[model samples]
Target chain A: MPSAAGPLKTTALTRLFRDMGARMVDFAGWELPVQFSSVLEEHQAVRTAAGLFDVSHMGEVEVRGRAALEVVQKLTSNDVSRLGPGQAQYTALTTDKGTFVDDIIVYRRDEDDFLAPIRSFHFIETAVGGTKCIVARTGYTGEDGFEIYAPPGDALDLFSALVREGSPHGLLPCGLGARDTLRLEARLLLYGNDLDETTTVLEAGLDSIVKLGKGPFIGSEALTREKERGPLRRLMGFEMIDAGIPRHGYPIRVEGAETGAVTSGTFGPTVKKSIGLAYFPSRAAGVGTRFSVGIRGRDAQAVIVPTPFYRRAH
Target chain B: MSKGNGIYPEDLKYTKEHEWLAVNGGVGTVGITHYAQSELGDIVYVELPAAGSPVVAGEEFGTVESVKAVSEIFAPVSGEVLEVNTALATSPETINKDPYGDGWLLKLKLADSKELDALMTAAEYRKYIEEEAN
Candidate 1:
């Protein structure tokens, strides 16, 4: 039987990606390239040079009305009042328990207009190679790059144009595989992997975005209470001290017993080590804390470490 | 990748699982096919049974880990493990760069020379992969 949701959705650049011999995979119900050349190579390119990525699967929303700010402010955890015209910030739509509905970027285009506030967006609306797109100085990867929000029809053209221009400068077309490794190295949390509605913002260590003094909003009550009580579990970073790649859902052990679960883990190509993120008891989540990650049913030694494992030189 | 030179040597016998065996006397050297390595992308780790271990034909003997996934390595024919490619422990990318030569995973003292007849010829394996792709 066919899936009730139907077949996977394809981005405008899907055909082009296939034509370029990219290896495709299913990601969040969308057909996207996992890699073109290789994950390691593409990751290095983005770190040292540049890489183009098709993130059209990310949803977009726009709001323009007198009550837009009132609604957005009430819905998001970040201080919407801080955003002036043509500004953006990473924020989250909170559940009633102060957990994430989704982590989003709020782009305030004007006094009562916000454009492209979803998973990612920056602060600019521009054109590239005659194709109009909302070019935001934002990316999931830690590198200084832009996420171009182009119309479905213009996506292929804009991608091609960027590739043509960037080819001489050594820009490889990256895929979701490279995107994942890059973000993990930067300690950027992925929703399904590192966070969910069951985990609160305080627990996720995103207090910077939660404005308790901004007056009551959807999740303010729970957030305030949680803040007073302190988070029970704290998400932290760790690296493998032994051979084996820590993977998502792997069991984390404090000694010989299960303590927490690995949320997102990978061989960070840039860091040249196996690194991961997991939630542990706040008391034991400090850096230099030793732990074990079970890989293929065998516990491997690991150690808690400071996050954002790779920082780009300014 | 390069699809590995697009050559499957006629001197070897192949399994449907994409492993190849070069039999000389009672010993058979084994490795994954070029098609297998190319499909697997970059190999980052290889886990093999230690020498003196016995492996049964059609059973998993070890594993190969790439950046994105882990694949079990299946034995082509029953044999006693003679040696493993220790270099792959630190430099597994050799499987991606040279799957046939330096990337050879294991050597076995054959348990059943007759089992080799059940595997495919290079030409037959080539046809098998072509069908698998479609």
Candidate 2:
């Protein structure tokens, strides 16, 4: 393997992961476990039962004082005023052009204090193995799960305890690889891949979170204009009809002409197919629209389909 | 075919690209090595040349795509593809579960038997892999 520049940063559970024989890889400058046993196995565990993930690498910021809600509402595209204490809403930190700076979740701890970034259940202030942390009913994976924001010093113990307790229910200590496949199968957008600086919120098909009627905020003008004009392109979900896995950055074609590229793609273990997300002309981004993804030197057959490929029965 | 021992299987000739060939009556059965399968994590797709296609030694023939990356499989020796593992189209993960037995990729009619002399023996391949890992 090629050497990475300088040293890769390690999370609090790095040592424990090494001892457990995890396959480590550099993910966005962090030395994180890509898999413990295998990607497919860990992915299946999450869908069938449960899985624990070390999401300490995800950024966490706490906003306090009297103007917390005002600051959050102005900075994010979602209507923060709608959230009550302990509630969370998936929103985006948008650029002026209605594109994303970063997609985050906002959790209302109180009228004056808030923490962020996913959509789903409320945040629970609890002590796990005597370690005080905020457990939020949120995750990138579409499965029912909680993301715990713990103090750095107490992360390892908290993670280990959760694994021990959850093991009997078939919980596995999943790594980034499984995390990625699971999220993609659920049609969750990854930051750098699906929601980059150039792609607008409306184009990403996340209009539900963009509350224009809530009043002025970052990117509102551009979003309002774009909404009036109608977005020319849209992010679409597709599955390979041929025997090849569509991958990130691979060129996508429509009728032998290069159109766009795959933003996120993988062989979904649970869905049991090669699924991916890519941008397409709005007119062409419809269910049953046939296209081709260029995989290696070949044009693999594919077709647009409804997203959230795997949904929880509940 | 020489009945061999362990994962390496002494009878199989190896390549620097981590592919193995089991020779029997001028025909060679090809598959990736144990080390290769384990390193690949999970094999999701396998692209192979059709029967009667020609392959050149040390040249690209097909590709094995794992969950993480794709690796090109190289020809161990020049030959005509006699049979391909069609079952792998749907069950590629079999390569990770059994790299040497049911995971065999293709059967080829060897163009030159002397090419076997240039390939690594099981013992030499093991030592080569150890040195390469470091």
Candidate 3:
């Protein structure tokens, strides 16, 4: 019961947790729920059927005006030029030097209102406050989703409304653990895990988000150059032939030599095998390239494959 | 000994690292105790040492990951790995259901018979764990 009273520093969920029996833990400084039922049960629920994530902890922002699409197109990676009303596209808001601000999703909910899913709740406030750009290019979840950037007083209520609506369409209050697994299964990079301040999206295998032919944005020039020159290192996925699970920074050794590092690894329930993604030298990133995972100083056999180790059952 | 978890066995010898060993004669078996698996949670994948491989004393051997965090499994007593419960590889949850039986991680030929005396009996181990809990 430490005095948890702050605006930018304190989590918005402090009020919600007091009532919901949520076991809160410090996640990147935000006190968020780790689990409601259990981590395993929640993870399985999402994989088997549905999950409603309390992404209220995440940020949301909207861009409004006639030049909304132009601002979005210039700032983000997706081709938002032909975006019509109510349509959304997954993209990334990158830095001017071809680095990542955050991987995001764009929602064209209506004619004038454009929604963005930025990284965290504070990002929207910062974006609106720091950069006086007329429009908001904030929240990003990489889904055909809309994150509402409104007053925090009513944000939790809006989240509940979405859960009430999305529940019927298959949504459960998913915690952070399942969120990590889901994004990793999709081979999407997390901020501190895969894409840091130095880790380029190019090395993270996020080229699809970039439109090299598109007009000038913040980092468009550097990205266009990198695309033509090709990346020095590239991201690739692989399955664990053996039982041992690799983790972030676990050395991906080739022929007893440490060649790369596993950015993400997990037991893929859908694929029924241990799958992980890693960054390796461009020459060694080819699919089917056999490698070894150095676990606790012991070398375990591994192999390079493709993105998305799991295919959700249709 | 587990945070009031009554699921531990007294006959088996345990390590501070959480591995348990049960040896009757030359044919000794190793596995994580019920308390250990419960603490670890639903194990998604298990890396079992191959049959006939030599495991040293207090050596790191395997790993288990659920959703958010991952933990490692170690060797309790040094011996030659006789056999691994292969079933745990495909369905590691057997550890959750039967850590004492089918969930038994591996079988080993106890390299030193005197090492058997080095482990704690069920009641004593239980007492030791209960003390650690507080």
Which candidate number maximizes lDDT? 2
Candidate 1 Cα misplacement greater than 4 A, ranges: A1-4, A111-122, B1-5
DockQ head-to-head 1 vs 2, winner: 2
Q: List-wise, what DockQ does each model earn? A: 0.41, 0.46, 0.35
Q: Which candidate wins on DockQ?
A: 2
DockQ of candidate model 3: 0.35
Of models 1 and 3, which has the larger TM-score? Answer: 1
Label model 3 with its docking quality class: acceptable
Residue A136 in model 3: lDDT? 28
Q: Write the per-residue lDDT of candidate 2 for residues A1-314, one digit (tens) a residue.
A: 23467787888998899888788888888879999988988999999999999988888899998899899999999999998888888999999999999999998884333445434668867666898778788888888888888899988888888889999999999989899999999999999999989999999999999999998998999999999988989999999998789999999998888889999999998889999999999888899999999988888899999989999998
lDDT of 2 at A100: 94
Displacement of residue A278 (Cα, Å) in model 2 is 0.5
- Please give, as one word, the docking class of candidate 2: acceptable
Q: After superposition, how far is residue A12 of candidate 3 from its true place, in Å?
A: 4.9
Ranking by TM-score: 2, 1, 3
Please write out the lDDT profile of model 3 over residues B1-134, one tens digit for every residue.
12536567667787766678887778788887666776665677776677878987777777766645577787777789888888886787888778888888888888877766667777776777677767
Candidate 3 lDDT tens digits, A155-247? 566556656777776666666766666667767677777776565667777777777777888788878888888888887888877657778
